[model samples]
Target chain A: MSLDKADVVKIAHLARIAIDEEMIPEYTNNLSGILELVEQMNAVDTDAVAPMAHPLDMVQRLREDQVSEENQRDKFQEISPKVENGLFLVPQVIE
Target chain B: MEWETVIGLEIHAQLATKSKIFSGASTAYGAEPNTQACAVDLGLPGVLPVLNKEAVAMAVKFGVAIDAEIGKRSVFARKNYFYPDLPKGYQISQFELPIVGLGHLDIELEDGSTKTVGVTRAHLEEDAGKSLHGEFQGMTGIDLNRAGTPLLEIVSEPDMRSAKEAVAYMRKIHSIVTYLGICDGNMQEGSFRCDANVSIRPKGQEEYGTRAELKNINSFRFVEKAINIEVERQIDVLESGGKVVQETRLYDADKDETRSMRSKEEANDYRYFPDPDLLPVEIEDGFIEAARAALPELPDQKKQRYIADFGLPSYDAGVLTADRETALFFEQVVEKSGADAKLCANWVQGELSAALNKDGLEIAQSPVNAEMMSGMMQRMADNTISGKIAKQVFQAMWAGEGDADAVIEAKGLKQITDSGAIETIIDDILANNAAQVEQYRGGNEKVFGFFVGQVMKASQGKANPQQVNELLKSKLQA
Candidate 1:
């Protein structure tokens, strides 16, 4: 139920977060404590109950399939860092 | 060692919806870049995703078409990954609880046998945008217009034993989805795409070999070729004292080879968790029933009906029903022409298919519409034009000449059905081919075909073939 230093490092890497090597212990402790709380919550047997997905007892609101949005490309791209030929450009991510 | 190939397909069928899956932005393809991307699709802060009712209904219809168990309490989860195409760091997808489950599709095999492929699940997810790699200098151009498009990712079990079986399975899925009107099933525009997991095991081995997930295979031919090449590569690796590495590979159809997608190797973990922004979608029985009621007759059902009702051969039924549009065109021809269904099936599968393929047009985009096709079929059915001459009339119709009657009149290609005119042509053919007549009377019955051919030729291929046969037989005997 607890995360080790390597686990925290891998988690940080997967999350694309930059964490200092010296701060790994502190982050691991914090993350492990959160996991322990989850463990304590998981200890109670609730097999008969359905898994809750949201805090509020409500289903997802459904929207009708209609095109309500207009052409806001110029307005939206005005805030982007880089754009060319009506495209958002980023570092090469060829895969 | 006899190696047996195992293939399982993961098909991503873009649902035919007007708007995005979770946003109101338009999902139309080929729009101006980023024009259809709204704040929600752009993943702006504080923007929540609302489920599209049509998307859910489409998914439900797909499930019902496949006889799948619709997930009443389906939940969306976050598939965490990092890519520029995915504006959000994580994709909202259904993980532990998918929308559809445990369906099966029976694919017709090469030998006229059927194999039921097990569909593991079909989950709804949003597609990532296109990453134009070489367009920008040291950067990728991203079009977020496709970022939030809804996709039904259908996963199949490793039930296919060959590349042909895999293609058959993909085609069956494509047919069913298009028939349900859930997906357009256009592989070229990437409305329908497939990723195959291919591996090989010994013939008698119960355990499977390590599989390589082949990505970027768009067309059915590429799917089959990719699986076959990947299987060969795996077998090569095994026989050369090396083990096959289980990884995602890219199928370069242009090169006809698969290469390792090394960039994705390190970051393969898609840490999935329940997405809290969206709540559980509780599909009730009433909703499922409505979707089921809205379901069109599926491809398999139509194929079976074509066989049972029309007495079409299994192959013809399969070909005619493989595409919903083609099947609709065939049925319309049958109804309009009042001809035999088998005859309509033949024209649809033979000449119509050839013309459509030659022009690289879909049945919907055919130059000759159903009415025109049925008109020609009616001519052939009512003996107004010989079948051979019908082909000529069809070419004329395809060339924008006119309807069957107009083309027949313009070309003077009406069948020589009048007894007097046909007998004149037959008498001339019989007189000119005195040698052939003697040969036929001398019991060399094969020359009867030559006599019939000569008669038809004299009639400019307009002689009714049955009448030609009868008159020629009686004349030669006398």
Candidate 2:
């Protein structure tokens, strides 16, 4: 399925990123090319082929049901770009 | 307009592995940032991921847990995505051949109705790093600490009809993951997360409606709210003769609404091809057999056994087996106390759960342990403590840091079941309450309770209530 410019605009808006209008045509063109490639797989006689989920067959491996460690917020916060009173600082995006 | 809510989910859970999936980096959380990310994770050029044996073992373990078809051989593919967190140019995931196949999970709703949700697949993948947006005026902060963490992506079919069922399905998944020790099931730390795909169609329509995918539902509450809002939004659009747009949306928990981030493009085809760097994983019969043997009793089987073997009601068994730790604790109590199984289940479900809830703690951090609880229950059975006193003893035992008998002795909380001593106290009470005693003698039978109360008070509220009642009734009749 070759999606047009309208499809690209809509998908970007749903995913919550502000996409520039100039980027729309390029994205649309690129996505259609991908869809075309996936179409090649469709030509295979896969009607009887079961959909594959994972790569291996295995069973249960259990832990000793113990909590071994705690998160180091102090250490993690040290790497944050902006920290105020042990809390991460972010730009005000909402009114 | 007639409509039906269609929902599916993609659950990402961190596997319980001592080492990271692709690299041998310690899977241990809370370490200093940049410490755990190895050369492979840091994307030092030419650094390749050496698959962790534990990670593969866990993947197979989960495959067996879900009763899914496991392929003898599985392959990994490269999913190309450019982001700060995904240090590798592409994330190596099981695109074509995954280890676990289709499975079904049965969920029980609060209304006592059961629904079956189909698990489309469970696959292995590496985690991306955390990107902190809005950290600066003109830039975003990137934390590469979480990069390359092993994740098990559990995809569910569009079998759920309502938000209630979606939540139910998530809870069942959560229980299984936690029970099997595959995932910590912590939403806050994002050890576990769910992405919801929701759409609405005519109630009986065979063709599917356009769907929207929402990410960042880190908690169950968020999942339910995000799906509900999205479902309503889709329904409203359809009813107004407007076409529902197919796109990806992010749930803004603060606003409790989903606004279009961007229109969704049909870009699922990432040109997935087999990853050549790593070898295909081949599991043998012995491997599957070992995994099966290691499988501790699953929740469903344990629930059934709890009901049949312990003579517990269905609800009680469900509550006890909801988490593995609680069930294990109950078992230990039963083993030590050798008390009635039903009563042991009661203490675990009733008193133990109450305390755990009050403190917002899991069973591992609970002040009460199984053996101690069993000792306390024994005290109750032996009449060493009354029901009312048992609660007091329980609290004392919880805070006192000792066994039930020790706490009882230290607090001097033993029940007064001495018949001769109780008779003396009862006689003294009768002498003092002469007017009430005379009335009781003249056939005001209820006055007997007042005398019994006096005897209990004389015994400092520890008098055997049943014995006091019997003695008071007989003495009053005389």
Candidate 3:
């Protein structure tokens, strides 16, 4: 139930969170304490109950398939950091 | 030592809906980049997603067509990943519970045998945007126009052992989705795309070998080629005393090779969890029943009906009913022309198919539609035009020269079925070719074909072939 320093480092890498090398031990301890609380909750067996997708017991609302939005490229792009030719430009990402 | 190749396909079929799956943004393609992207699709703050009912209905219809179990309560999960195309840093997809589950499709193999490919599951997911890689000042340009589009990701089990079978299976799925009117099935437009998982093992082995997923195969031909190359690569790896590493590989269609996608491989660990913003979607029995009732005749049913009712050969039936548009066009020709079903099948499978393939046009985009095609067929059936002359009329009709009657009249290509006219042409031919006529009387029955050809040629290929044969026989023997 407890996470080690290596585990914290890997988790931070996966989550795309940047942490200092010296901060790894402190973060690991904090994360392990949170896991301990989760372990206590998991100990309460509820095998008969089904897994829930949401906390609220409500169904999702459905929308009709209609095009009501107009072209707002200028309005939306006003807030972007970098845009060219109506495209949002980001650092080069190749896959 | 023999090796067996195991191939499976994961197809992403964009559902034919007017708007985005969870937003009201227009899902039209080829728009100005970012023009159609709204707040919800851009993942702006304080925005919530509502499911599109049409997409749900379409998915249900697909499940019904495949005779699959439709999940009564499906949950949407967040697939966390980092990509420029994906704006929200995660994609809303189905994790454990998908929309359609445990379906199977029967694909016709090269040997005319049918094999049932198991469809593991089909889940609904939102598509990511496009990242234009080059010529963006050394930066990638993101277009969110494609984001939030609904895609039904259909996964097939590793049941195929060859590339041909895999293509057949992919084609069958394409036909079914298009038949259901759920997906457009346009590969060029990226509406319908496929990724393949390929592995190889020793013959008679129960355990599957390590699989490498092939991505970016956009065409059916490429699908077959990529899988074959990947399988060969795996065999080479194993034969050389090396183990194949499981990774994602890009299919370089230009070089006809697959190279490991190093970056995408490290990002494979997708931590999936249910999206708290969306609750479970519970389907009612009434909705399922409605989808079933509204289901049109699928390809298999239509093919069988063509065999039983129309007396068409199974091969002809299969070719005619390959896709929904082609099947509808064939039926329209039959209904409008009132010609024999066998003849209708021939024209549809022969000239119509050839012209469409030549021009790279779909049946729906044919210049000579069902009405004109059937008109031409009618003329042929009623002996108003000889089969030879009908081809000329068909060509003219295809060139926008008008329908059957108009083209026949315009080009003076009508059949000269009048016995008097045919007899005159035959007399002229017999008189001009006395040497051949003498040879005909000298027991050279093969010379008879020469006389018939001469008569038809004299009549400008307008003489009815059967009439020419009978009249030539009486004259030459006399």
Kindly list the per-residue Cα lDDT of model 2 for residues B296-330, writing each as its tens digit: 78888899999899988888888888778888999
Off by over 4 Å in 3: none
Q: Please give the lDDT score for candidate 3.
A: 0.91
Error of 3 at B229 (Å): 1.6
Candidate 1 deviation (Cα RMSD): 1.9
Q: Is candidate 1 or candidate 2 better by TM-score?
A: 1
lDDT of 1 by residue, A1-95 (tens): 78888898788888889999999999999999998999998999999998777788988889999988898999999999999999999988763
Q: Please provide, for model 3 over B308-360, each residue's C-alpha lDDT reduced to its tens digit, 9 standing for 90 to 100.
A: 99999888888888888988998999999999999888888888889889999
**TM-score of chain A for each candidate?**
0.90, 0.63, 0.87
Clashing pairs in 1: none
The model with the greatest lDDT is 3
Whichever of 1 and 3 has more DockQ, that candidate is: 3
Worst ten in a row by lDDT for model 3 chain A:
A6-15
> TM-score for each prediction?
0.96, 0.80, 0.97
Find the 10 residues in a row with the least total lDDT in model 1 chain B.
B260-269
